[model samples]
Target: MTLQYIQDKEGKTTGVIIPIKEWQSLKEKYSELQEEVEPSTELMSWQKKILDERISDYFDDPENVGDFERTLDDIEKSL
Candidate 1:
């Protein structure tokens, strides 16, 4: 693989340029090299139970839930 350096007006190296094919190949290989992790069965069971309870509680008092879309819009505006 050959790398070409991009220079600024003063000839100072600021970035690099590589062939598109080489870049795509590198990206593909790096993606394949990522580690895969399996969630623990015990922890997943506990999380599922908690989520189910929350859903049940929400249904028990549907009027108590705030406007989800408005809440999300407010959050995005704040960010």
Candidate 2:
């Protein structure tokens, strides 16, 4: 599975070249990765908390809450 890189004037790789057999083997191996990889639990939890707080704060304004809820409801209904 030998691979070679073509570099540019800046010495950065511009492209890669692999044998057909090696490319075929790589394709077969990659095809086995059929599942969506979930993010780490801690990261996901932190993201959820941050999003929830942002949403909560955005809706805390009386005028904005009505528009936000209406927009959210419309989006949910469309979904």
Candidate 3:
């Protein structure tokens, strides 16, 4: 990978210049790096609470967690 640095008038490094082909290849390889739309304020708060509660429950009783293989078999049967 090659990198070109952009400098200010004072010769201080400010930005980078990437070749178009290299940039395109990087974009394809890391498509998920694209900007994401954030959830609404209310939805974000609700999701945080739900996730916190789930983590707490899991830690409170790790033994009570569902069996992975059995859960998959049950799901397949339902389908």
Candidate 4:
């Protein structure tokens, strides 16, 4: 697992950064860490179609594809 640390000027580790998937996993393991917010698990049909297309694209060229963040940024830019 890759994590980034936010450090203070004196080099003290202030906080740790993790991927969203890992955060969700942590929330599942520890009840105390969970919040009241519950995100929807269901994807709309259009969302599912887009995901399927992206999965197909990924399988076609696994090495050349952008990571989720970059892809999301590109999408947001287009929007």
Candidate 5:
């Protein structure tokens, strides 16, 4: 993608100019650019219950829980 630069009278870059087509493509590829998105602020009851169950399970079998490296390695190997 070629970007055009806008310079001030002092020759310092003041802004950038992306082609409309490229800008539209970028907006499509990146969700944040597509709109003003709001993130979920609170967990619903079912979500909380699921997390509580997971926590209880962890406490019940602390030794069996996967560490970060092991979990990441398992994911990567699966992929």
Candidate 6:
């Protein structure tokens, strides 16, 4: 597998990077480690619909811009 180096924002090399193929394989294995998880097309579609509705609602409500930003921050923190 191919590999490369990761860099910092200041253009300094930080560490080695795994190749994309290996990274994907690692991800699959990692997910498998969490055996409780299952594939869910229906949940994914529902989430997509909810996301689309929220985005459209954001555009409709100017006052919600700040709420949207805070929501994003909360989601990021949760991640």
lDDT of 6 by residue, 1-79 (tens): 7889789999899999887779778778798644544555565778899999999998898585666688999999999
lDDT of each: 0.82, 0.77, 0.83, 0.89, 0.90, 0.79
Error of 1 at 28 (Å): 21
**TM-score between candidate 3 and the true structure:** 0.44
Measured by lDDT, the strongest candidate is: 5
Candidate 1: worst 10 consecutive residues by lDDT? 32-41
Candidate 1 lDDT, 1-79, residue by residue in tens: 9999999999999999989889778767877533333344565778989999989999999888888899999999999
Q: Could you give candidate 4's per-residue lDDT for residues 1-79 as a string of tens digits? A: 7799999999999999999999889889987777555666889999999999999998998897668999899999999
Write one digit per residue (lDDT tens) for candidate 5, span 1-79.
Answer: 9999999999999999999999889888998876654567789999999999999998999897768998999999999
On the 0 to 100 scale, the lDDT of residue 73 in model 6 is 96
**For model 6, how many clashes?**
0
Candidate 4 lDDT for residue 22: 92
Candidate 3, backbone clash total: 0
Q: What's the count of clashing pairs in each model shown?
A: 0, 0, 0, 0, 0, 0
Q: Model 5: how far is 50 from its true place, Å?
A: 0.8
C-alpha RMSD of each candidate structure in angstroms: 7.8, 9.2, 15.1, 12.8, 13.5, 11.8
Pitting candidate 4 against candidate 5, the one with the higher TM-score is 5
What's the candidate order when arranged by decreasing TM-score?
5, 3, 4, 1, 2, 6
TM-score of each: 0.39, 0.36, 0.44, 0.40, 0.45, 0.29
Candidate 6 is scored at a TM of: 0.29
